[model samples]
Target: MTGFVYSESYLNHITGTGHPESPDRLKAIADHVRNSEYWNSLKSIKPNVISTNIIQLIHSGSYINSVSEACENGFPFLDFGDTAICRESYSVAKLAVGGVVQAVDEIFNGNLDNAFCAVRPPGHHAEAESAMGFCLFNNVAIAAKYAQKKYNIEKVLILDWDVHHGNGTQHIFDSDPTVFYLSLHQYPFYPGTGSKNETGTGDGLGATKNFPLSAGSGDKEYMDIFENILPEIVIQYSPSLIILSAGFDAHYRDPIANMNVSEESFSRMTKIVVKLSREVCEGKLISVLEGGYDLNALVSSVEHHLKALQGN
Candidate 1:
């Protein structure tokens, strides 16, 4: 069965009014899944609050303390302005990381084939020392580190399909060969990091890959890379685990981004990843939520993603 990691407490990390990354996002997904036909089939998993030491796998101690202080003091935002947070946001962010880590544990323990984490305060933009793009902690990055340390996973493949480039994830793993970071995002966009020439560095040379597509690129443009380019990289890397920074903001209806990707395209992409995981990693894949602004579009896209993960 496919695992579904979530927690109602995730909604506690409120971003205040007019914020794109709000609690309603996960609430919509939770409500949709509960009412869907696949509700009974999905192995529901509740996430526990993990220790801060686990978070240190990706973020520094000082940075973690800074986040805690900011939240404790009720700071309005973490970064310059995008990452709004309240008093409970720090705890909620830890729960988000815990959710992803639990999914990894379930997969490694032979309890599930694959899983999707419906977490809040989307994490792709978080760096090792700072929070960016509405992320307080890097969920997928911490999970990757946890898997490698606890389960002795030899290699990990992080595929980020967010509309904005995951500059933090890329920079975190840029010098590490054991983890390969691949990002397909809109170019010249927010943060302005992912570019064709910005491959890996040091020991991780050629391990990082970026496919920057211009705005208005739709399913055809994305599928070309997913079908034609992604498989080869997966086979060659032969990682022990596959993690997706599953962001739905690339959808046509999303208010934040300017991509025309449809829900059907998200399903097809998930199917391809599922196939690749089966071929390379025994179908051990974990998808962590990142960015998806529009409530209806996010819900539909997540439904399609979950169905594909279920092999429906």
Candidate 2:
């Protein structure tokens, strides 16, 4: 198996000074992943930039142009207070999307059983046509749709266990039942979406599941929910491929949000998801980093995450 990592060389230009979602978030995780024993189990590569058409699969041309435009002329603050763009934002965002795509390539090519793309600015917050929540593009959504278009997989399973709900991802696929979107997040959290009642709509109805926990939720709450909800959903759906929205902001030490998840908590949650992938997707899984603010938590949590990915 391979755990693909992108250098912070690109991320350096994606954020503003004093940003929580800054490039250092990725650097910390990379250092942890590479220095660990699990690094020996992984083949490493820098993620490439995505082609324009590849991005157009889920994002509209206008939205794509907006990002490109932002890249050319310095940058613009994304929307409200969610995200920012800079001269190199488009390039790095494409690299993030390409990281997931390349992970899919490695799994499909049989070079690896699975991968974890340690990339940012985190996705799951970027909608189809909008760049928000520090995300310039929806990397997971982009990779999922790319898998379908390129492989005719028809069904993709996205497990987003970020402390905050994956509102953008849920929004893009809410009406498209071809994908099963499962998310567990803190209730009344940022972006204020992903309520239990926000199950898919129309043909997509019942194809989505959201479990919103209270603040201070920890491993016990997470493990309990996964054992009960995750298994039933995966068995019923039987997805051809699985993608993980791995976010570490849930760690107890994170400054941006309140959640009782610890480093060991990340390890436990990752192990649960890995087991499910083994049963349903033939171990075909690609994990992409979404959000994790605390440097130490990010580093330690990723080390834990990669160990589980290595079957340790």
Q: Give the winner by lDDT.
A: 1
**True lDDT of residue 152, candidate 1:** 91
1-312, model 1: which lDDT tens digit per residue? 899999999999988888898899999999999899999999999997789999999999999999999999999988888789999999999999989999999999999999999998788889999999899998989989999999998899999998999999999999999999999998889979999998899999988999999999999999999999999999999999999999999999999899999999999999999999999999999999999999999999999999999998
Candidates' C-alpha lDDT: 0.94, 0.84
Clashes of each: 0, 0
Candidate 2 per-residue lDDT, tens place, 21-87, comes to: 8887777677777786667778896787668899898899999998788679875676765677778
The TM-scores of all predictions, comma-separated, are 0.99, 0.96
Which pairs of residues collide in model 1? none
After superposition, the stretches of candidate 2 with alpha carbons farther than 4 Å from their true spots are none
Backbone collision tally, model 1? 0
Candidate 1 at 284: error in angstroms?
Answer: 0.4
